[model samples]
Target chain A: MAEIAWREALNQALAEEMERDANVFLMGEEVARYDGAYKVSQGLLAKFGSARVVDTPISELGFAGLGVGAALVGLRPVIEMMTWNFAVLAMDQIVHNAAKVRQMSGGQLRCPIVFRGPNGAGGRLAAQHSQSLEANYAHFPGLKVVAPSTPADAKGLLKASIRDDNPIVFLEAELLYGVKGEVPPGELLLPLGQASLKREGSDCTLITWSRMYYHAEEAARQLEAEGIHVDLLDLRTLKPLDEAAILTSVRKTNRAVIVEEGWSFCGVGAQLVDLIQSQAFDDLDAPVQRVTGLDVNRSYAAVLEHAAEVNPARIVAAVKQVLYREEG
Target chain B: MAPAYPKDLVLRFFRSMYLIRRFEERAAQAYGQGKINGFCHLYIGQEAVAVGVNEAVQPRDYLITAYRDHGYALARGADVGMVMAELFGRGTGYSKGKGGSMHIYDIEHNVLGGYGIVGGQIPLAAGTAFAARYRNDDRITVCYFGDAAANQGSFHETLNMAAKWSLPVIFLCENNRYGMGTAMTRVSAVAKVARRAVAYDMRAESVDGHDVLKVYETVKDCAAWCRSGKGPVLLEADTYRYRGHSMSDAATYRSKEEVEAERKSDPIPRLRAWAVSAQLATEAEFDALEAEVKATVDEAVKFADASPEPPVEELWTDHLVEPGERDVPPRERVRGVKVDWPRYPSGQELRVKWDLEPRIPVQDGEPHLKKPA
Candidate 1:
């Protein structure tokens, strides 16, 4: 295993996939010559050359639809949105064309394409650019949504997503781009929808993914030092959720807390709470608790921004609430 | 150049045009009987555009169109029985009755799909061309849309990107006067859709869509241009629809006299007149052709009627390609773009040799220089 940043892990997966399949190509705004907006696609243009690593104009709908068209004709196109926020402009193509193409064609065609980009809040970037858009896309049936937490998982799940024969919304976080972890030197293919139990205990269950996973990791460390052991489960894929893993952890711990960096109203965490309450109601010791980003437009100030999204403190508090730990 | 086109090809054009004409007529009748429910847009007057382009396009090439796709599907050689069955929402339909009239697609015919969204296929068409460029495959794509769709942001976005990449595709607009109830002049800043090509650094061509020979020859020449490593081309076929936009449209927007006047230049009769004048066939042969088309249309109706409703299990199926079939490099005929434009009496220069006259008054004060006189 070698220590690598999240961006480098994602870059390796893209470069390897392109090398494996001649049909796979990458295109997006500044993806080629600009080395990607976040530098995740750095050095790809030089390695793959121009034809395979293309730079598209800032026409999200056009290039997104273009990716769908290329996929329809047997080419595997990985379209990079500068950020998941801009993907809203291409929602018509995603919802109407990408998600519906396979079923609409009566299975005559395969839309083997992936729309990958940075998602969720970062720095002082307000409102438009700081949204977690997984739930919006995951609502559609035809699309498979994946949001990996660690560097190794990002690399492995990305490879699996590229090789899969369906449209996938691969969400990556800007905050995790520079985060470093040990990634396997050889090939790593993590199957989609398989949740990883980062930590196991008997007191409570902490379920999270993507940016929120980092916060949950810290919360688990804080709780472990104070002798409050909890099960930390990272859901790698969102749409085809790991229900068994979630149910098993909730049954064993008898308490559950969901931490997510999204608004609470009809959010992924809300959905998880519903699933746990309905499926594992008899096994629970107390009602499930949630730690979600405040439903606001997101503030530009550092203090307000930190308070708006999730933090380790919030996750720890939610865990205590679920476990009925009333005092310090 | 030769004196005239082959008699077989010309007659086949008439057969295709006449077949589409009758197919839509029966589709309209089926709609009245409630056999075909939902938004059914008939291709009554734009037969020359689809027949002309479909005849000119090769098997390796592709065709995608808007909701008004019954005729183009026929022109691209999709099974009439299947297309009719799709309209009737039967099990035997091309899309397993999952996709209705607005969304018929077939891989065998190289027909991408009949999209329901206005101007939605414009960007998608460019993407298909992008695939060809990526694979170094020479298959050029032809995308069809209406005048109303030209006003969409995607039309601008797609054209600019396609031209920037020099993608091999043709964006053909059928200017059928009204977009739903709104006229093109009322909505678009520039009613001449072909003129929009100039902003994208691409060439444009406007042809008399009532003339099948003109449309067929022009598309062939345009395909040749795309194959020679050029950017996308925007071709405008000035035509009209005799029917309302869809089954629900009352068509109270246009005057009855305007429709009656446009009917005088109906593509079916006009092509028959031109083909007969050029001595491609006799009147008796055309009459026989008409009788044959009527029988074919009747058979398609019977086939659609007899087809069973899709099974309950069908709803759960076709959501994704089989897992085993995923990620395999595409099965493609790597043969690069082969130009099918034959060296014969065809295209604009060939027009002088034939003594055919226009049936409708050709419009003047054109927006583009390539506008047919």
Candidate 2:
């Protein structure tokens, strides 16, 4: 095991996978000579050479579609979007080609490609740059969506994603790149669709993933100080959500609070709420509370931007409301 | 210069073009008879482009095109029976009835697909070429799109990337003059589609699409240029589609005189006249070849008509590779055992277990780091 940043863990995973499989290559805008927009792919070009780590022109739809075509053949391509925000231009390839090829071709083709990059808000980037689009991607059936909060999970989940024989939309949090954690040495492939329990409690359950998991953890600490302990669940993968872990936590606490960095309406939290109410309805003592980003375009001002988003304070308040300590 | 193709090869080109013309006519008839359903775009007048290009490239080379693709598929050697079965929405189709006229894919023949979206295949062609280069292979990818597709954002983006990476791809624009009903003059600032290639510093040319030999020679040279690592080239074939955009189109945008003028240059009769004039084959030989192609089309139609529709059980399949493992079927109630909390060791504990010093100690109440203000 070794301590590394989340970005380093992702880089390590790419280097290791590229080294393992000759067919596995990386392509995207600035992934090679530029060493990745956020430097998640730093040193890969030097380590793997240009053929394996390719730099492409600023053509999201083009390169993304190209990656799908390559995947249709026998190549395992890791396509890096500068950010998930820029990936909007390539939604047709992602939604129509990569996602539907296997089914449309009746198992004749399998697009084993991974489209990864930093996702969700990063400071006051604002509007186009700060959108959290995990739900929109997870809404599609053929895609495997995974967002890891820690460096270990980032390395493990990415390795698994690269190996999985399906199109995966791996959403990495920009804000969590510098966050440090211990990653296991050698090949450590974490299973997708399994939720991790960050903390143990019975008063209330906090469900979140990716960057929001940190906020939910902090909220758990605050609730513990107030003599009301809560369970913190990190939903590592969104599409094949760890529903058993969620129901387990909600059933034990009889109260739940969901946190997300995306907009309130039709967000991942909304789907969680539906799952909880439908599955754990008999065990609930109070209505599930959701803390999500305000439904508006992200602001340019730092203060307004912070106010419009989900944070530890919001998670704490939502947990308190679910526990009946604060009014809804 | 005249193409130096052999007598047999020239006859084959004529036969290929006629096959496409007759296949498309039958397809349109099938649509009218309610045998084939959904958006069917006939390649009536543009048979030479598909046949000429396919003949120029080797079998190992890749080909992709837009929705008006029965000609491209037939030209690329996709089985006529399977292609017709796909149009009939039968289980024996190339895509097993899931993809109709718009999405015919044949992996074995290296025909990537007949994409529905205009210009959608451009980027995919670039990527396929990138794969060939990555694998150190010598195969080139040929992409075909209509004139209207040249104005799409993907066309510009793909051309830039293909040139930048020096990928082995040939971008062929079938300039059918109209994007559905909209005239090319109204949509494009530049008159010629090949002129757009200069923006990417790539070599480009325009050719007479109705002339099979011209298209064959141009595509042959361009495909060779790409395969020899000269980078991507754009070739705009000035072709025309005699039929409407889709079966639903009334085609009131153009006058009858314009249609008549285009018909004067119909590729099939032109090829037959050339073959006879050049002494490649006599009128009797041309008639015999036409009869042979007609019989082939008839056999394909019979095969497709006899093929069964995909079973209802097939509807739930193919949407995913491992459906059972991924899809959690809906249940009446919440199932599965409750997972215990603290499922794994904490990050701090892991650091100690792995004998590594903590980079950033885990602490409570510390504000998360935000990007520089």
Candidate 3:
């Protein structure tokens, strides 16, 4: 197995899926001639030709709705939004139309569609470009939300999302796209709703996903030096939450800390904290702590940006705080 | 090919219209008697739109529509009793009582479910056309909606996509002048819905929906254009609904005089006049046809009334997918995901466990189940 960047892994998955399926097609603003805004769809236009790799107008709502419509009729369409922030423009179609089509049609129609692109805090992209809407999307029931951290997970989850019978929101972290990992060759499909144990420990449980999984691992290593063992859980699929895995981890450690890139209030991290409290209340030895991005948008300056969001240092502090409370 | 409709064909169209009118009237009565529940949109004054349009398309072509769908289903050859049972939420219904009056689907006939939300069926119809093209089928889609839906975002979006891709679909807008309690004049600045088709650069026209011959000929021409791969077309059937929007409608949106005026120009009587003038049928023959239609509707009602209500156990039958069934399996998933031989979970009992960590990988060294050559 050779190591490849997360973005390249995504590209390979698209190429493989397209080669295998005649009905699978791609559509987005820069997906065709320009390769892709993020270059994840690079080399696809040349390989699949124009019919499959379609370049759409800047009409997000129109094309997204059209993708849903096409999915209903039998075409498996992978729609790439330039960024997750832009998906808000088409939220009506994604939420009301695509997500609910199967249930509302009384099971008459099923949308085998995927909406994927860059998401979460990506460097200093600022307010409009850098935002995680996973919590907002996960609020809806019929939708499946997937956020992949590693290159292998990116390729496998994207392939699985495309193949799924239901509509899926595949949220790719912009910061993690260039990160590299070993991906099994040929074809692979990682199942949705299964969390991965990024690192094992005993003293406390650190639950996170996407780019934050890396931060959680870093914090866990630092705490291991301080004699505080931390178990890191990467929630590959946010919607399904992998409740069994999370509760099991919480039950084992009696202490929990949730981390997310979005603002803490009503964010996906907050939802996790609630789930832990409800499921493993008796097992918890200390109040659950959380490390999340600030409520305001990220500032352009490096200093302000660093203070605006959670990082490895903040995660370590939160874990330490939970452990100290457990001792007290 | 442009020859005048034969006597038999003309008589058949007349009979279909009469059947729809009588059936809808009976349905309204049933609703009044508390037999039918939920929303019931009648097609009392819109008979020609269904008859004329159905005559244009082939049996294999796809058909989709909005909530005003009783006439369209009847025109598409859905069993009258089955449709009535659907309205009554019975087991023998087309959707097994899952879909009511506003939503009826027949996959075998390619009649997609009627949508409740205004203008929702527009994009779905385009998708159906896309599928037809992908399969290399000559079948075209005929999507019917109202003038109100023409103002919806889906209408514009679907039209643009259909035009850009040259999908084989015909957007049939039955401009019945009202959407529920609101009049067209109140909602849209430009009352003519057909003119909006120019935005999509699709071929479009306004036809007198009251004239069955006109609607039939126009839809036939449009259907031909779509079948020939010339892309989508728009046919605005300018019709009117004699009854209120639904069974509960008071119809205060328009005056009684307007209703009377439209009734005077009713499609059935106009067609009957031509049939008689052309010596296609006598007054006695027309009366006999009307009597036959009433008897057919009466028989349908009896059949529906006698039909047993859907059993409670069957309510959940079509609600969810079974264990082995996936709605639409992506091509790659079916072909790419490899499997090994005979490792299927054995026996009646099955147990599953949740792991905090990723589960152990199954070995791939075993001989894979090979497909028979």
Q: Please name the candidate that would achieve the greatest lDDT relative to the true structure.
A: 1
lDDT of 2 by residue, B101-208 (tens): 888877657777888878888888987887777666789999999999999999998988777677789899999999999999997898588888878777787889
Q: Model 1: residues >4 Å from true position, as ranges?
A: B1-3, B325-373
Highest-scoring model, TM-score: 1
Q: Write the per-residue lDDT of candidate 1 for residues B114-149, one digit (tens) a residue.
A: 898898888889988877766566789999999999
Assess candidate 1 and give its lDDT: 0.85
Alpha-carbon runs more than 4 Å astray in model 3: A104-106, A123-126, A263-266, A295-308, A326-328, B1-3, B90-92, B282-323, B326-373
Q: Per-residue alpha-carbon lDDT of model 2 for A90-165, expressed as tens digits? A: 9999998899877765556678899999899998798999999999998997899998899999999999898887
Candidates ranked by lDDT: 1, 2, 3
Q: Tell me the lDDT of model 2 at B275.
A: 80
Alpha-carbon TM-score of each model against the true structure: 0.93, 0.90, 0.86
True contacts kept of each: 0.56, 0.49, 0.21
Candidate 2 has an lDDT of 0.84
Give the alpha carbon lDDT tens digit for every residue of B13-92 in model 3.
89999989998988898899888889999999899999998888898888988898889988777678777877877656
Model-by-model DockQ, in order: 0.39, 0.24, 0.14
lDDT string for model 1 (A169-220, tens) is: 9999988999999998988899988999999999999999998888999999
